[model samples]
Target: MKAEILYEAISEINPKYIEEADMRVITKINPWKRFLVAAACLILCISLSIPALAATDNSFAYELLYTVSPELAQNLKPVRETCEDDGIKMEVVAASIEGDTVNILLAMQDMTGNRITASSDLMDSYSIHMPYDQTACCQLEKYDSETGIALWSITIDQAESKLKPGDKITFSVSEILSQKEHTEIKLDSIDVSNIIEATEFTVDPQIRGGAGNFDEDSMECKRLLLPEENGYKLCDGVILTGTGMVDGKLHIQCKYDDILNTDNHGYIYLKNSSGEVDEYYSSISFWADNKTDSYEEYIFDIPYDELAEFEIWGEFWTCNNAPIQGEWQVTFAISE
Candidate 1:
């Protein structure tokens, strides 16, 4: 009797706690005496629909932003994510506007990738391609026209991390007022992409330089002969330019001729911004040190910039007049 009484009491309490609304009651809400029921229902429906619409809008905007290149990461560098996804790319070219003015664009593949694609008008604006590293703080140091110095550095924060293979990387670029800093709005795009790998050029100074027009003419290597089409290769001699405000080391790597061996000595020089030839353009010698191949090494520091060219040479003599081949390579880096 006691247990039965407790069970009856619990049933009455559970009913009281139940929500008062049910499906049958909703259908029989006394339609003839309709009150504020329909209005309340309409308001509830609107509230729920708004968030759905906003979510869709946000999704579309993010998609568009990912296709764009950030102007900040100077260079055609898009925020590439190659590990999981292929990269979205844009080619930037220069278009002369007026005197010192130029127009930069975000373009699609024209003569390179596909056969039918024409000059894509993806985006053309009053901008310049500031090719930069998408990695944060990675500023591309444009060579100083006047100084032979390339003392540029960027400190990537902890947030932007070291990359691994097949990782997705996002790049964000912002506006540059103008060439005359703060002149006009330039760009504000965030390019999304991934890099499968990076291609590097570890210069081989000796064989990498232009086949100087000095083949049979003079001692000093010619200035700006042309970018080597065949990459670094041993030749009769070499002619090329160096970079820096002060003399930096230049390394020439070549296969050591074992038989008779070879020897020649030379020096490098520079032409200053004033168009005057100088031994030291920017505290660095416009230098040349040509000599017969003793063993085979790389690097002879010199001061040079775009404005000033280099004409370095070894003793106007020839050694084992054969091409320096093998895994010979060159390396040029700043010391100061």
Candidate 2:
């Protein structure tokens, strides 16, 4: 009964106060609400073994309130359940249900070192297990450098209207990727600036997905030399295959080997003299083989004469090549 009142009082806290609480300010809440918040914090301090708490600092209060309030818990809290492996900790910070959709927030923290960065992402190797049939997607919401924590949001949509409060769901991840690097494409053999028009050097690869003005009917897959020979090593698992002026546009092609496993892919951009990226560009992706070899073509709308003023830049990740593989799973109940 006390937990219920504490939950209600915390729930009544102004949303604005909750936002300001991030800055460690506790204000405008009534005396009773403030007392409940303090009492909840005391309980959590004992339950979670918190070392200390500042009376004026309410940043921790928000998390404490989540323990008592289920609906509010979906946003932030240190859940009771956690799995730690390979010097990394995975915890279900929050879980709640809205209508037929269930949203779960999971946090991954690197305790031993700084391996978990802002770019740390799941390698499409995670799975969600629930009793009901549902479709779920997991995405990295944000990372806090101060606490060495990265939060991921998982949204699950039930097929039928069968989901309710207090239903348990299991979230699991097999691998995590970090240390994403971005670098300039420098070739020892291929001179990108002097590449002439070579529309004949194009090959038709299996289309996967694309962006920009590329037509689906006219799939323009630019063929390039094999990475084993003429390819320039851009990063781990990614290679620069070809560069040429196809028609009036500049075509930069890259090969992603073992794409399905590594999640090794990147963005190609042209940077000008002022270090500003050219936003107007189109790209298409295709598979040399179904799951093993993937190729991406970046088409830039610029004249060959101006190509000398621009440098090729790429943001790539070979995440799966050196992934932190572990079985991190957590079962948490959602509240409506």
Candidate 3:
């Protein structure tokens, strides 16, 4: 065995090795110099768990966040950010592919020294969804342009797999050190973007519903989903309707004349002048005690774009109209 290699290996041993009686200074001895060093001190036999190329974490604990689907449009945003220090590695793999939804297999493991295991089969791995619609690519081969590899490797050169939308699967640590302590992982949030057909008409969905009850000078227009003062129905689709060509601002006049209200973010989506459906959070802000006698205003803004279809979504609670009111108006400013 290489003497220098053996020397280096000995240095990595825990401090306990130094106190052993009869053991001379490992002058030129290192574990890598001879596998026998491990065979002698540690008789544990670990098997070939995962593919040889994948790297596994050396530490026992890890954090993992798997984004289900990646938005594969022209404009892609950050799906999720992950970080690891204690010998952990992250893996991405393909889960499913249905129309536009792309599911991704995310895995975290103790990769101090071992192969990481990931699979395309949905039967065994866990995954998350993201907007990975490579539909904008003129050619199927352009996938590499979008991302060189489907799965991103946090530790080694090669990752387990590449992934697409709507796919399902479980990703796991194929091989890990038996001696590693504290083994586990976490999931964080994700970001997404859209694929645009036309540059001038991209579905800029995120900025929607931002500004609210500004200093009054920015207030522009107001209209209801229908002529009735009732708040817009979620699933059926109501428009913050009347506005300049730009998707500027949105306002809602709640007609629940009698109920106190607390606003929340809901599942709002968009359909541009182009017909593509884009979903975003409808940031609704309203007075908590809405029935306090003074008329309160609820404001939501849509991102500015030359094209869009504004819609509301997400969980809804019943609105009691004792201060019973009618027709609510939503409005926005026109952008040039």
Candidate 4:
């Protein structure tokens, strides 16, 4: 947005021209046609700094001018970049660069059906690649249910002033999730009233990380439950590994498969016979098997005699393991 930045961006343009194939065909362009195109580009560039004009929609010429003289590039017409896959179309609508940040606007539309929704998410499956080291994040900006179109905003920032005007940036998404589902599960099979303290416990190396009053790093390491039997299935891709009383505390462990991809996860707690959940509970999470499979253990300080009046309850988010997978990529340069 600064004049120095624009100068640096336009300085990369090469003014020289070389003869190419079909030169005669290219020279056939009428002077009037060329004049009209140039006039249109001049109007567009002049409106670039107009807030009202940009509020509606506009394209920056920073990338387009990188290959020609500043004068020619300033008058050159802009082209829209788009890609389609699996009945879906993705278009790079607008982009801009400000100091150490690059902002991009993208639009996606379902071509054959009304599958695109306001709840759709990239689910951390999107990537932005730049010539320099940077951090990128995206969020849904808007959605039109009637048109099956969704607009997303992506921001890429660098720790230092590494972003340049003509730098090529590629944005891609590999997976998309829609129709979020959240449910509460009741564990009626587990007789909390008859729960007994375990004699032996294992120091589960699968413990990735956790938080709570339970000092996992010290204090004799209050033990993890042993895989005694096939545990209760809380939901799809989620299992209640085991439950036991450990050192006067109730420990409830649950396993989730392919958490990185599916994001199938939940929290475990207890509800009274009147179906009221006690808010005083803490949890620690770890890798049950590997990075793909995760485990979370909830601990409660309730007395053993009072356990019977409480029932185990779980609240989970399941995407039905349904993700639309395809390659959607757009490459363009940031402009003022």
Candidate 5:
């Protein structure tokens, strides 16, 4: 079957149901025979009730906000505005204004049966304008292949003087580009020379920690206090405390002696044994609740078996992506 024909069949079903069908189809057929199996699965899924699938609302923003802060979810306002052109649809699902920040959830779909997504590159292709002068961050939260739809979360930090309560901000997009025209840079082209500096370190295997709690008794925790010469300082006073594997994920912690400095920020990257970069997720911040020493933790989703063969790299940069002058790499190795 042609790719477009297969996509059309898949698009008839709901995105959520397509996930289970995708898994079953993948497991049942060989890699070369995936298209045939996908077509068969799509036919089976379409026979079911379309209204039942439509009843389930799988909004990524709804789930994320509810999970993190229910109060924020309660105050969210729906945005019924949508823009469509060139076989592409952009829907402004909802928006929430909290203090100095306004969060907007957008859903984009490719109606041309293409497997394109609202990736960062695609977002960069368009210009988003708000009512006020603000700094914005856009993250592609989720993508549904079945429907060729992608969900995005955009947060805008408005100046205190510019934004007030009961103010509705109007957002507009311009210069939208086709996804096919976007050129993706290969991973090999990433130049890291002088961008980061790294040193090798090991974590003892006997140490362990429960969910959300660090094992203080573990040797890993003790090593967090390594002397200045052995440890890497993320900034002038921010120290890379320790590295460890917690619950099959690579965990690295840092101590920020100077939390008041807003300019201090950094990022952590992972490289596998093959030199290819691995995708990892982390949340780093400068604030700590009622603690004398503020800390930041980076956790990479890596399997235990592959953790031993991986290396961790750290880079100190301003939040705006400006390079901080210094060597900033800390490699990791698991010691038996």
Candidate 6:
């Protein structure tokens, strides 16, 4: 019974519905029919009592803050700062602050227990100041090297000093850059044919940067041909460069040739033209690239006259999470 051991025995019989179900329906079942439908849903969740269905729908903190910004997962506020130098230990647990954006949910440890790795190249050494502003532009929506934990988001565009709601935010980490050295690489296959190459784009909607920024003025930019598989090399090419349409949302940028350490992993999809496949509304918006090393601007709230012809693809995960196999794609058209 191996679908990863029947998903670890359905995560030990209903770990919050195997952590909120739908992992593409558990990787398209068929491990002995998903272990007889996970042993008949673990014998009907042990004759219906899984803690009374986790005490009536708790959505695991909005499914982990909806993987970042499902509108900042409504009214969240649970903080308990902690710190410790050198051997690392930091924590910020939770936070939220809509408007000028600011969502945090950090956690790090190694206090000598050893087993660390949360480096997206140390995420620019982290920051979120407010002793008088200037330094809020962090974004690494999720990382969990088996639980060192991370989910940051800070965007204070300073529209005349904004960030009020009992403001006292100061989540600085000065330096992290961890790695106690752990290596485990196992792969039987990951061809991805020949990476990918085929592009198209057309869209023009504009309003430029102000008054709510609704720009798309004919988005066109594409380039993605990364794949040095087997010998492993997940980046050294990936560029879709532009596309934006605020307010009604649908941004697409994608530039990465390096410096996008994993744990925020990556995978994008959106197939339409009647094939209908719009995985979870999309959401990712990292940044840090003065010329390579970071660029992920997904974020599709959908609504660009309903996007006509679509076909996006995915693949990105290295730096230990491994899964760099890819034929990442692209296709788009909407210029009636």
Candidate with best TM-score: 2
- Given candidate 4, what's the lDDT at residue 199? 70
What RMSD value applies to candidate 4? 15.6
Range of the 10 consecutive residues with the lowest summed lDDT in candidate 1: 327-336
TM-score of each: 0.16, 0.58, 0.20, 0.57, 0.35, 0.23
| lDDT of residue 35 for candidate 6 | 19
lDDT of 5: 0.43
Which prediction has more favorable lDDT, 2 or 5?
2
Model 3 poorest 10 in a row by lDDT: 135-144
Between prediction 2 and prediction 4, the one with superior TM-score is 2
| Per-residue lDDT of candidate 6, residues 1-336 (tens digit) | 744344334333322332254331111221112212434432221221011212324345335445544434444455545656655566554554545444454545555654445443343434333423342344345555554554444343334455555445444444333431222221112222222222333222121121112233322222211212222233434444554454455555454544434323343456666767665243433334243244555555655555545555555433433222211111111010
Answer with 1 or 3, whichever has the higher TM-score: 3
Write one digit per residue (lDDT tens) for candidate 1, span 222-242. 221222233332234322222
How many angstroms is residue 213 displaced in model 5 relative to the true structure, after the best TM-score fit?
36
Report every candidate's CA lDDT: 0.22, 0.61, 0.24, 0.61, 0.43, 0.39
The digit string of per-residue lDDT tens for model 4 on 1-336 reads: 985455445333321111121111111212112222434433333322112222333323232222222333232223257889898888776566655555565678889986677767676666565444565556555676777777665555565547666665666677887764567878876789788787766565555655446466743244777654587787787788877888888888788768677766667778887878774355666675446777777788899988888888877766664678888877676665
Name the lDDT value of residue 19 in candidate 6: 28
Clashing pairs in 2: none
Alpha carbon deviation, residue 181, candidate 4 (Å): 1.5
Q: What's the lDDT for candidate 4?
A: 0.61
